[model samples]
Target: MNVYAKNILRFVVIVFLQVLILNRITLHWFPEPAGALFIPAIYPLFILLLPFETPVWVLLLSGFTLGVTIDSFMTTAGMHACATIFMAYLRTNVLNALMPRNLSEYINQQPSIKTMGWMPFLVYSGFLLLIHHLVFFSVESWSAASIGSLLLKIAASFVTSMAFILVYILLFTRQNVARA
Candidate 1:
């Protein structure tokens, strides 16, 4: 399949999964008054997995579109857009740092555990997801007074989101289990 077709499919599928299923799941380990409130989000994986050659403008646009889509569904009032766009803005720097060489060196490759190796791919995705969650939770709370609550929300949401992301890779990828 073509990259555009595949990405479009990813966009639809991830958005559906997020809006229909993941959004309905509200996780809390403690009482509402004590701990953080969040849901596990895997939608950010769409932005993370785009082809290496994708331009920054496309990333920004895609991120905005995706975030706006989710916000429209959740009625979060552009909170998701703000977080996703920030993450999109940082994607290039994160990829460049985690990548061994310039993105040009990899013609047809997109990021995955297969291409970037386990550690680098994890760091790349993890860092970005953390940024996304941090911005999202911080914006949701919109306060610096409760640093503990903000950190708890970020960490909890990040871990939850990453778990769902791993399941997504395990279920969806073609060579995820096969050795090259």
Candidate 2:
């Protein structure tokens, strides 16, 4: 399939899953301190999957749009937009830093375990997820007035988001490898 068509499909599927399925999930064991961190916000995966060769401006625009879509559903104003754009800005540098020296030729491809190896790919995803979750939860709890709780929330949410992303990558890795 064409890249544009595939991207549209991915966007639709992920948005549907996120808003319809994941949004309904509530872990009673570890509820958000401020009730805003339960939503996994997996829509950023779409931004992460964008082709590396895509223009920075295009990536930022797409990230902003995706964030806005999620914000519209979650009613969080521009929090997601702000976090996503921040991550988008950092993506290129992260990719460049983690990529193998001799494998720079694959700059046009969307990053995956097959393209970047499991360790680097996980590190990249984990780093971005941490940043995104930190910014998102911090903004959501801007008036909490407790630095300790905020740090704990960020750390917990980061671990939770990493688990979600790791499971997602594992589940789809086979399909991605088959296609490649």
Candidate that would win on TM-score: 1
- TM-score to native of every candidate shown: 0.95, 0.87
Judged by lDDT, which candidate is best?
Answer: 1
lDDT agreement with native, every candidate: 0.90, 0.79
lDDT of 2 by residue, 1-180 (tens): 788998999989888988998888754325555433465557778888888677789888988998999889989999999899999888888888887653347655788887877888888888887888888878887876787777776776677667776777777655644555
lDDT of 1 by residue, 1-180 (tens): 898999999999999999999999999866776575678999999999998878999999999999999999999989999999999999999999888789978998899988988899899999999999989988988989989877877887788899999999878878634555
Off by more than 4 A, model 1: 176-180
